[model samples]
Target: MASKPMNVVVIGGSLGGLMHGIVLKRLGHTVRILERNPSPLLHNQGAGVVAGNDTQDFFQHHDLTHRSLAVTSHLRHYLDVKGNEIHREEYAQQMTSWDLLYYVLRANFDRVESGYCTLPPVQDGEGKATYQYGHTVTALRDLGPDAGVELSFRDRDGESGKRTADLVIAADGGSSTVRKLLQPDVERKYVGYVAWRGTVPERSLSAAATAALAEKFTFFHASGVQVLAYLIPVPDGALEPGKRLMNWVWYVNYAPGSAAYRELMTDVDGKAHAVTLPAGKMAPRVWHKQKAVAAAALPPQFADIVAKTEQPFIQAITDVLSPCNTYLDGRVLLVGDALAGFRPHTAASTSQAAYDALMLDAMLRGEMSRQEWAARTMEYARRVQRRGVEMGERSQFGRHPYAGTYPG
Candidate 1:
């Protein structure tokens, strides 16, 4: 006789959610993803992401093949404000665009037509799973000592409903509703700086400018700010000739609750902006000032890359820790950034998510009891989160005088 399938509900259809769903589905468990967004196509934003060797293994373990990976430019050099090359090292691995990764993963999920709020059964077997979009989980209830837990959600049409599952996985991102419901006491803290990111077409730059920024990855470090630029390939070679895009990010320190903070956080129309920094809205004058700062401070090669940028965007950095206690009343599980969001310094955000998926897969496979799984998973999360924090603390490049400098 075959064993019974586990009914699993994964909240947040982002990278982590999808990853978990795919792995669980492969393991013969019924999986469903609940996403608040209306559809997956709404996400058009893209960013360059660096994945290390560990990440490569994580991808392969989840059945992500080489064909699914995006071709990214490798890291080449780090330069100081005066155009002098400070450090040069060859990156062992490559980088890729976030959109490419998402697209590949979504295709791998193989149920894109079904929305996350609908909860329509996509896979049929002894174990069936589904994803329901526009379903905002409002509350969770502990169903007695023996029964499984219950989840309450607001559907797309604002109708409220409840469902019970053997396991609940919260991969819902930094602002996870499941996390809030499970661990209401945990708080999110803002880091001391904001990140400005944008992409420019290679054709928009002169030949010399293009040559200067054609590297895989490059960083420009100055006194109070640092800029990073990298190359990304676009489709349509020669005939349509899509320009190679240069993705750049600028990190500037800003005091919390200050006028400059307000100004920097405000949109071009003077309205408060949230989440991502708006593209093409910043004033040309402000950009010119930034360019001037780059020109005056950054090394010649790095400054040239910044000067070639079309429109630079900004985003405030924030960090959040998972609740100190694991197991929500001994039922729900929180994973990935939904538990502990780190500063983007270590480039481990995606890697950590991959780790969570693998670990959860192992635990759900009956390698350990539910309580033991929770303890071990939480320990792994804590260790990863601690690493992220350490990297973030050390990432104070502009604020610290000795940052990016090597002692002879």
Candidate 2:
């Protein structure tokens, strides 16, 4: 154990917050994760996440459940518009549904029964991890050096409460409230594009589509569009053949402030979303138009997969990087997407969260100082963020020398 145990408060009980909370809890610190979402389960809108190296390493080190976490694909195929393979490579990738990752992390942290993870909670001595849902942090106060920070929040009942912690982690995502409070000047820049994403059940894929994509990470790149498909574990965390999900993402440019952008962002109820239009909420005409474009531009297999999808979502791509991550005398940290939101081309967001958590662990264990930890995390964030921008530019605009390859 360390010389002192901390009372840590993690704002945002998503992947980033959970990873940090779990690590701190295992190091004998008491952790409380405050999540704004009132529901016991947070939905990822049927999206898939790349299980990068740090993500896998995090589970190997911190999660005691030791469950298999991803669906593996050992081949990559770049197909022409006619569905014939233009290029094939022996590349392996691990993919997981966002729901699976959340359930697994939640199981390891607070042992919340989400049905997806039925394994018994692992044992840790002296440390406690608790999650409070429907809590929105409203204010933060620093009490001088080494004196900890206090947070004011409103619960689901609209009741207000205050909590103080030796350390506070803000992993609240790209549009982070904490970040806005601390660094008001920081902003996210839209990348003039959005991803049209959807998933079909493996069993729903036709024989030809299955044969082309079942075990391969498949891609079809056009002039200004790129679509890729791969398998991911299903909602219930099953990875068996025909039980997985065939997840696909198509990147298409939509110039900011254009009429096309406006229509794409306006949902079924006429609510205009700033970043994401979730599954089942997209306007019918908008989706119909996109589907028509897919049919004309995408490979037959890719188009079929898109057509079979019941509900598709849209995520507008953006880039955000904070000048610094640590604040309030090292008692508060802006972590993960809160610190740096990258383009999805890198698929490094989750891995960035894991990396941040592990670096925090190292700091708490006296392997590094707080300044060192902050610097290291920020450096990694910048590198990945830049690479993501380059990769997106290369694929969508053919403007960069960077190859159209994802971070493995």
- Superposition-based RMSD of candidate 1 using all C-alpha atoms, in angstroms: 5.0
TM agreement with the true structure for every prediction: 0.83, 0.95
Q: Give the alpha-carbon lDDT of every model.
A: 0.66, 0.88
Q: After superposition on all CA atoms, what RMSD does each candidate show versus the true structure?
A: 5.0, 3.1
Error of 2 at 320 (Å): 0.3
Off by over 4 Å in 1: 1-3, 42-44, 64-68, 72-76, 113-129, 202-215, 233-244, 280-292, 304-311, 368-376, 397-408
Model 1, range 1-408, lDDT digits (tens) per residue?
014676778888877787888877877877888888876443644466766555566677754333545445555776655545667777644565565556556655654432211122344442455767888888888886457778899988889998887777888888778777767887776677888777667667556555555755777554456667766544221112245566677777777878777777677776776556576777666677778866666556655657776667777788887854346455577877897786776677777778777766666677656567567666766776787666555555324432453211
User: Which segments of model 2 are wrong by more than 4 Å?
Assistant: 399-408
Best by TM-score: 2
Q: Which 10-residue span in candidate 1 carries the lowest summed lDDT?
A: 113-122
